[model samples]
Target: MGEDHMERLIEGHKRFLAEVFPGRKSQFHLLAETQAPEWLFITCSDSRVLPDLILGTGPGDLFITRNAGNVVPLTSQDVDGCTATIEYAVEVLRVKHAILCGHSDCGAMKAALDRAGLDALPKARRWLQHVEAAFAHRQPVNSAEGESAELASLIRGNVVAQLWNLKAQPSVVRAVDEGRLTVHGWYYDILSGRIEEYDEELRKFVVLGE
Candidate 1:
């Protein structure tokens, strides 16, 4: 079975080399030399949250970082993976927009909402501690999000929580202060395939397009 999967991957690579790569050879060649992505997208590792598909982006367009729950750790001494990546994107890549995007029905948020299954996963439990701050930032439940209102509220709150943490990074703070970076929090509904941006001024989630 594994061999069959490997064969399929090989076949796919061949298809890319033959059919896909040729049409975009120049684009790939430029990317081979260097990448100067403008948007730093921080999102969940959920298979459903395809940033490229949802944002209509392709290779070299976005500098992406992903982890369960889309977490940004809040420790001054500890250099977590998420923060390290943000520092690089800001200081080196010089990305202009840093977006923290969370999604509906996220397993990480579900795990956070219920600690029943937490014992089996020690690392995950510890990592989700970052989400505790989300409770304080929870947006009022939106009926539009349906029966999973509690979960959806927490998800939006997590986006806001992480967005602040992203801002707290020294590099991010400097970038923003120097007028080099902008930060955003976003909630994506997998069922409806719609995205909402958290309006910091209004303190509410609004349609991303609007």
Candidate 2:
């Protein structure tokens, strides 16, 4: 069954090479020369968490970092791929906006809740500790909003926690301090197909602006 899926993927690649790539060949060549991506998008490693497809963004438009839970780790000494990528994006790539996006029905958040499932993967269990900060940062739960208020709060909390982690990044901190970068926290709802942004001053989640 997986072989069939692989065959389909190969066929799709052939189509891109034959059709899509030919038309966009020159554009791709130029991109290969230099990439001036404007946004640093931090999202989950989930197959469904495709920022480009959802945001209508192209390769040169975004610098992305993906991980299980879209986590941004603090505690400066512990270095990892996500932080390294973020540092490069902020300091070298000079992306103007850094966005930390979390989603509904996240398996990572569910794992955090369950705890037991994470025990087997010691590294992952330790990594998820970073998300605990999300609890304090989460906005007040809206009971009217469908689903468990507790779960929603945790999800929202993760966004806030990761956003803080994003800010604490040295590169992000320097860029923001220089007034050259803006940071954002977003929650994407799979069921509704809508995104909500965290408003720092308002301390609430609002539908993204037009």
Candidate 3:
């Protein structure tokens, strides 16, 4: 880490210690020993994204895994950190719900959609192969929202694609069959600060809480 970057993070930690930590000290102590997080949060690795800040979740409430496109590869035999964490969350932690969330204006999705631009980034181009399924899963684009809708629709499609991949994981498959778990797909629109949940039964996206 850069010295300047470390200094900024330390300064932020100081603020957290002074302002945010005191109010939640008692809760923090219990979490220090053990954590029984109930939710698994899967999202993109975006600088502006913070799950706890957006969802108002406390430290131990969520187990999170972030990646370039929040892509979950079903065919890979190689051990991926995201899959390993998800397996632990399902099998060990026994988390009851797993939320796969994708966001608007996602660089990954945009890159996946525009392949020619990524010709130079061989690794990233290869990594995004996981999202090819998103095109088939895309929601009917909303014309009213213009360009924003196109991106949001694609982002939501990624959530759907990844959720299916997540369900294909052995641990997650068994957990759901046992009725010990539920998987959710979410579209988080940063500009609007609105969260829409994918209704698996309805095959539609609806604003959270009706």
Best by lDDT: 1
| TM value for model 2 | 0.94
TM-score computed on alpha carbons, candidate 1 = 0.96
Ranking by TM-score: 1, 2, 3
C-alpha lDDT of all candidate models, in order: 0.92, 0.88, 0.89
Give the Å error, residue 183, model 2. Answer: 0.6
The best-first sequence of candidates by lDDT reads 1, 3, 2
Q: What is the lDDT of candidate 3?
A: 0.89
Question: How many steric clashes does model 1 contain?
Answer: 0
The sequence of per-residue lDDT tens digits that candidate 3 reaches over residues 82-177 is 899999999999999999988878999999878998999998998899999998888865566535666768888888889899999999999999
Best by TM-score: 1
Q: How many residue pairs clash in each candidate?
A: 0, 0, 0
Model 1 per-residue lDDT tens digits across residues 1-210: 599989999999999999999999999999998999999999999999999999999999999999999999887467778888999999999999999999999999999999888999998988998899998888886787654889988999999999988889899999999998999999999999999999999999999988
Report residue 210 deviation for candidate 1 (angstroms): 1.0
TM-score of every model? 0.96, 0.94, 0.93
The C-alpha stretches of model 1 lying farther than 4 A from their native spots are none
Worst 10 residues of 1 by lDDT: 140-149
